[model samples]
Target: MAACAYCGTTILFGGIKDDDLRFCNDECFENGYALVIARSVSDNVVKREANKIYNGACPKCQGIGPVDVHVSHRVYSVLLYSSWSSIPNICCRSCGLKSQASNALFSLFCGWWGFPYGLIMTPIQIVRNIFGMARPPEEFAPSEKLENLVRIDLATQYIEEKSMPPPVNDV
Candidate 1:
């Protein structure tokens, strides 16, 4: 099994690129190569819909454009780097609480890698992740209208974005 070049996670189904590097998804590949992220087709659609919602009022503060956007990045174990044991989230910059939560969880399990960076960073991230999850800003908070088609689009975008090497057999 090849390991992901970005996070060092074992790649079970990802393909090899340039005859050497392997990544689970474009996210990892981009991270590995330090390339700009390539947004998939659905990402544009969600951005359009989300813009439509934010176009009106803030979900939390009822303010405007500078509002925060929440995106989830999965964390892999620094020690194991196995797909089976990812921490689910690495950080959410929009909310400080969620940042901490994700970090703390990672530190608890992967804090001993290559010195003490994990120990130093995990606690901070955990607090942020949990706090963000628990008390998102008014603008970031979920709204009743958020549960409709907008949500479906976002979910679809996430699923599609994560599906490395898009499927050829479109149905």
Candidate 2:
């Protein structure tokens, strides 16, 4: 029996892809694929960051000034192999500009897949493109407003309680 390349489990001769297969089953193959893709996405993100720091020039004003960028990946639990499982995006803090790294990445992958623009039409691909675009202040500032509101409310409550009369015992 050959060992599965991913899980290291023994592959039975009659089970799934037979004993000669590298993976024991489709699940193992897909899990391995996800790991590979996720790693690829992370590597791409690192490259992008390095480029932004070392080579990314402003396309609009052509001024390289305080360009803040962040990259992250999301895994689609239900997607199959090559089903838009990993996504990455870039944001420029200087000009508040954001762009989908995944779209370009996906486009490249689709080209490799021999599909014409297949990456853009995928739901996850579309989402990946849209997500990085200039988001609202709240989108990035998760609790800015909430924190201010809580502070105000606490101040108001303190004032009201301080102004109230002491409790009187009922005979």
Candidate 3:
């Protein structure tokens, strides 16, 4: 008899699926084993579809643009210059707009990079960068208000970028 992987309940070995593996019982098999695998697969599909929707839309107009837009990832060196960062941006063949692929990614980067209020600093940094100011130092502290500001800026940028007309020349 094999023990349940999760609860360790003793059970007779049940037959396998295609992989020839054994399980303790139907409950343990379904809840402990199969559900985990299935959840991963479902998550992957959802992520792919979200990416498809994000990349397929026109970066400038947010409308469905030309079908030939290419999605690519690029690595950039941040302030430390030793560690490299990977950023996903989209290049449009129709509108010629090149910008970050997803707002969620921008949010994640801020959250992950030790910025307490990254959601706010990110767009401020972007706007400051656009206006020729040095981005706030990475170690700069952020507040809850800053986080809200960053989220608002990101939303506005998204809306503006999506509503603008596509480029005239077909790239």
* lDDT agreement with native, every candidate: 0.46, 0.41, 0.37
Q: What's the best-to-worst order under lDDT? A: 1, 2, 3
TM-score of each candidate?
A: 0.29, 0.25, 0.21
The residue-by-residue lDDT of candidate 3 on 57-139, one tens digit each, is: 66556766332223222222234232223332232333322333333244335333433334344554444323321222122
Model 3 bad stretches (over 4 Å): 1-56, 66-80, 90-171
Ranking 1 against 3 by TM-score, winner: 1
> Which run of 10 residues does model 3 get worst, by summed lDDT?
132-141
Model 3 global lDDT (CA atoms, 0 to 1): 0.37
Residue pairs in collision within model 2: 68-93
Off by over 4 Å in 1: 1-48, 51-68, 71-106, 139-171
By lDDT, the better pick of 1 and 2 is 1
Off by over 4 Å in 2: 1-62, 70-121, 136-171
In the order shown, the candidates' Cα RMSDs to the true structure are 10.8, 19.5, 18.2
